[model samples]
Target: MGRWEPNARGRLERAALDLYLERGFEQTTVAEIAGRAGLTERTFFRYFADKREVLFWGSAALQEHLVDAVAGAPDCLAPIDVIAGAVEVAGERMQERREGARRRQAVIVANAELRERELIKLANLSAALAGALRERGVDDPAASLAAEAGIAVFKIAFQRWIDDDDRDLTSLIRESFGDLKAVTAGT
Candidate 1:
């Protein structure tokens, strides 16, 4: 209850996720999360916009990483290849937060509002990805198509990674991309 909570942001995030998994996202409140973390309600607001934000606190940074990866890729690569590179980078980052990512995904799936938010977040990321591709001199449907396809592959790979923690996320993403290719090939 003291004013100096070391790692307050991390503590708040852990507290919020715990409360969310315990009481359901909609059933939980900022005050409850703050109290659980042994902090003030105001402290919760300082870290997140609301209880729902606790699940998405890292999304902005994720988006930045995705965009950076896309831009950082070699210019000679095709649009899809560039997208795959970005996806691989993002997948590797996800691996570092595997357990937390799994818990957060479960929480998102359990709440309709959170799920909607997640879709919106994905849409934003897709748009950002497309923009990043365009910046790389990619044109029109190619950029949009690659971005959309990348997101689809990412969704499947992320789900599979969460379903079983045995495999690295980057590998799962690669497998998911292969699955997409195979399915589209009608083979």
Candidate 2:
């Protein structure tokens, strides 16, 4: 059986973020992360492939939540409605992690490689959302459009949420969604 550490992953993530914030992302090394966590480099690797994986642990969970939400949305809802509901559900899960998320975002934004990884992650998520919409019988460009729009709203809402602690992600998501509709309806 594999060795079990109750909070190994969490410790590693915290340590990595702390190091990233102090020394910057590209400057932070895996050994330094492991040392800060009071664990070995081997233990760090046990939890993550490398240092970049440190900031991304919650992303996989968020994607799964979004996928589940879209898949389970009521059939009567439109595509955007389904996406909004999914975003709301995913947003709720992130409320408690806002501070950590903000810090992680700072690290990603400050580094080129991290930013590229983030773009790739978002693209994968958008594609997944589109595929889910297709499974719900949405047509070609419509599904792609709806998914990308939802992601754009999500991105805007996230920025607003991180900037203002009092801001609710779901409300921002809805407002941004409305903003998109209003802007597009004029054309």
Candidate 3:
């Protein structure tokens, strides 16, 4: 609540999400978000480049985590399996923040610009995954194909996760991967 609070970034994010939900993303401003958090506008700028960044600020870190997971996977695994394991680990991390993720998805769904930004973030993530696969000695089209498939698996599982309350994201991710494998195998 204080200007000097230790979790200024967290406080700002909470405040921004609250405002985005209450007033809509286009109607909210950085100053209002900062004020709601009992922080200064400068403090808000320090944590996020703009209000949209409040929703997308974690993209780079998530990408890096996935890349690291892929790179660290066992050499015996195929490219797709490596990606499967990486996305499952990512899903487990996301499963821990279900409520927050649900709310964030709601906000993104309400805004067209936010939706486009989300797609761009996903594309970047896919590219990063492909790069990681290539580094692991996967060939060009294979790396790209596996990366795109992995993103598709993540996207489908994520939507299912958002829509269903009974299933955990990790299971959804694994199930989606299995479905992909099944389709490719002509099952």
Candidate 4:
């Protein structure tokens, strides 16, 4: 009800997720989300492109973080190791917001469109990582493969982390990466 609302972005995200969980993503509207957040539709637009973006607004930042991590990694590390470290750093950040991650994953899993969008985001992340590896002198195929594998490890670990409340995401990511290496090593 005031001209200046603190944390408008946070308020909008919370309202959108709550409405999506309550009424289903397809049934929720921007107007309803804005009303629930006690902000005008114009104010909501200032924070998010649309209602669906509320769930995915962090994708770009996450991608940037991963890319920067890989770029800053030591040259002695292998491509996969660089990716692993990057994702672990990301996991630590996500661990700080575990509940929000769980809720967002739930919303994405329940909707086909959202799941597709999630996949696209992952694909983009993988590509960005591969590019970073190439910048570090890693060749094709190896870079792409390592990047894809890293995303796979991150995805699996993220799912397991959300499902098991007792496990931390970084631990799960390490376990998943170890599993990947084991499978590749044929042992």
Top candidate on lDDT is 4
Which pairs of residues clash in candidate 4, taking residues 3 or more apart in a chain or in different chains?
Answer: none
TM-scores of the candidates are: 0.95, 0.94, 0.95, 0.97
lDDT of 1 at 138: 92
Query: Where in model 4 is the C-alpha error above 4 Å?
Result: none
Candidate 2 lDDT tens digits, 73-184: 9999999899889988888888888888899999999999999999888888888889999999999898999999989999889999989989888888888999999999
Question: Residue 144 of model 2: what lDDT?
Answer: 93
How well is each residue in 1-187 modelled by candidate 4, as lDDT tens digits?
Answer: 3477899999999999999999899999999999999999989988888888898889999999999999999989988999999999999988978888988888999999999999999999999999999999999999999999999999999999999999999999999999999999999
Q: Rank the candidates by TM-score, best first.
A: 4, 3, 1, 2
Please report, as a residue range, the 10-residue window in candidate 2 with the lowest summed lDDT.
Answer: 1-10
TM-score of 4: 0.97
lDDT of 4: 0.94
Shift of residue 87 alpha carbon in model 2, Å: 1.0
Give one digit per residue, the lDDT tens place, for model 1 in 41-70: 877777788787778878899899999999
Candidate 1 structure, TM-score to reference: 0.95
Show pairs that collide, candidate 3.
none
* Candidate 3 TM-score, true structure as reference: 0.95
How badly does each model clash, as a count of residue pairs? Answer: 0, 0, 0, 0
